[model samples]
Target: MTRRGVIAAVLGSAVAGHIVLGVVAGGAALTAIRAYAAPPAEPVFPAPARPVSPIVSPRWSTERARNDAGEARTVIAALAPLNGRTVADIGAGEGYYEPPLAHAVGRKGHVIAEDIDAATVTRLARRVRPLANVAARLGRPDDAALAPASVDVVLMVHMYHEIGEPYALLWRLRRSLRVGGRIAIVDADRPSGEHGTPPQLLACELGAIGYARTSSRPLGDGVYLAIFEPRALPDTIRVCR
Candidate 1:
């Protein structure tokens, strides 16, 4: 072959060899293209599958659930007997609910005050130290980090909608409940971003998470109480879809 033809042939052969090995060339140099599989496609996160109507705007302060016109009385009425049992107050800001929950659970019982923020947990840990029966725990966006089958009741007061990963969180939370443990939610009937979740949407999410809404009652002032019992959930959650 002519000198130019010989060089072209060699280069062409090099490229053909690479193609046979399944690597694509990117530059004019005859360097071997590393056959790399495209990095595994990123996982697609599940999105809210359905539209559940929500209520309106920044939620009420922790004080709202703490008082809210006898809310403490309302919560006490909704739960199973509080004496001698374990209770979880999720998103337990300022540890406001821990004292009462501890009191209701009695000295024989225990109350776990949980929050996702480390600062919040630190403060809560110190806040509940004097309560004896009350303790603080640090949780995650998708898990409350409570021990398995540890709590008799989970109080999601005014913070259900604030759960950034509700499906995963609730699914995992089922393992934290005792045999007949129950969940309680107290939220306004507004949009979630607005810090509210409508009752119907609340029930749907609970059912999806393998919880059955057993009792629901008006707590007045736009807030309502919902009690749910743990049930068998499917192998995979469908999210809001």
Candidate 2:
């Protein structure tokens, strides 16, 4: 073949390869630009809003109710010595303990059964209406509806850990107690296995809220009881069960 012919063939091949390379590069750049312009994917679903009131349905669950009842009885026994005295049962579900507590306090002493749920409040009111000494209270998210420094005892049975705002509730409870008023916290001793707060964490949180750990004793095979009181009060005011 002639030298010119060979040179022309080589030059033609080089131009063709250059064109192919340019096309590939342009295609890749276009793909990248398109990917960059695409919008981000939306979330699968929106998160539900935080509730304003305590969840009542969870309290009425069969297992929870039974646990609450047993803990309520223990709390009653602990406060039994305070006969004919004012008591407030915070988070009183289904009024299971309100009736007996009202009876213990007698017609003269007052019992405030406070629940955050309006439905639970209604149930409590119906259960305690016959008793003149008992008053059903519907609580707000930030505070209990009880009168400040009016209650001689505050009972929170198997319900403290479930509170959405523990610090706010504890502060309100502290304010509600009389000079020598006592606070009782009863909860499951063992781990719930669910993602609920553990008993030790409850005690620690209560202690942080100015409550002194008075006693921690066994309630049943797997359950335990803890009693706490304001650190400023005398030791005799807070009784351990």
Candidate 3:
């Protein structure tokens, strides 16, 4: 064999011996090789300076109870004139507002029900399967994952406090809103750790990312509605503590 061919043969034999030894050693060597050969896992964005509440459960409360309290109706009313508008329900756990929003928006309009949990997204998809105007999909903790300039209204009901990367999420979500679009948030006036966001803290966090509050009003029972519109983003984001 030529010198090059001889060198190749030796290398091949060494590799073969390594595999044979790996097999004899119960695959530990092979596992180590594979571990080094595998690509790195995807990186996740870090949380902002503020505290993020843990997601306790998918359902905030029973549908019957919320309905009885006129929660959905009040929130829908706060978003007035929903007809022919594209609306997105971010972190849409259990999709409590999908049907009513679908009805309010009419057949000409559309509703996107999005959640971060895969199982929740699957359930939402099944629940809204009959509604032709609604689409259910999965999202990420740090992103809404909606189309650019596609929605006229974004509803974040009882879930804003649980966003892990609130700053990054809101910054990315601004691209999804159309001209004259607004984000409607319904949360309790409490600390984020308590499954609610205080109105002042919410304003500070959103304002840091260039979202201006269009309106803020009480919906009773500790829940409040705050509407925000996107403005020019600052060159550097100043995270709220």
Candidate 4:
């Protein structure tokens, strides 16, 4: 007879003591459980509201940044103690950061070049094939798919804004960090599509995911590098399906 009455009738009898909700449209049924018994989980920061950047070849960005008045050296310095350690290059376009990572970690160490696109990973695999220490792997939009406690450093250069699911991704990153490991994010203060993430917002999102920003400095030539360490106890991460 009424909206509430019809909903109750459809969800009737089965949920005796609990609240129920159902939506019927075009002969399709969608049922939802409304257990108001306990408080709902808190919401995490939403993804940035900005245009997504077009994925480009690493040849344009990778080496150029390296040549910029020691930008590459400064980034490596922030991720210090990387010798003989494992590193991940999230969104490793064209294997741009792989060579440096491989060199820094040395022959005893390994580098995981992870990208969300299969083609990108394939190309990166080919690009880094010359380096014995570097390998490429495909990653998901919401997860980098890194092994637990397997990486000493994770680099997200000019790519944090391109991530579709930052909260889930950042949370997943926590599972990849070893003790004393660090995350280095490089970007400018411009809008997302313009190739940058505001340092304050970047810190806030990472902080929400249980990362503590240890230091930040100008990455030379406008880009900024912020370094963060994982907290001892991570907060309950919100999984984005």
Cα lDDT computed for each candidate against the true fold = 0.75, 0.66, 0.85, 0.75
Clashing pairs in 3: none
* 1-241: candidate 4 lDDT, tens digit per residue: 9999989987776674244333234222221111111113434646644566776655444466467667667788777778899989898888767778889999899999998989878888989989999989999988899887788888988888778778768767776777667888988887777777878878877766667798888865577999987663334553321
Candidate 3 lDDT tens digits, 1-241? 9999999999999999998887899765554443223122323434666667888888988888888889889889889899999999998988899999999999999999999999999999999999999999899988889887789999999999989888778877777887778889999999888888999889988887778898999989899999998766655667677
Candidate 4, after superposition: displacement of residue 91 in Å? Answer: 0.7
Residue-level lDDT for 113 in candidate 2: 87
Could you give candidate 1's per-residue lDDT for residues 126-210 as a string of tens digits?
8888998988888897889988778889898888877766776776677778766888998898877666788998888878766
Q: Tell me each candidate's RMSD, in Å, in order.
A: 16.5, 23.9, 16.1, 14.4
lDDT of 2 by residue, 42-154 (tens): 21221112222234352535756666657556667766676779988888887767777877888678888888888778877887888898888888755786776688888
Report how far off residue 139 is in candidate 3 (Å): 0.6
Cα RMSD of predicted structure 4: 14.4
TM-score list, all predictions: 0.74, 0.66, 0.80, 0.73
Collision count for each candidate, in order = 8, 0, 0, 0
Winning model by TM-score: 3
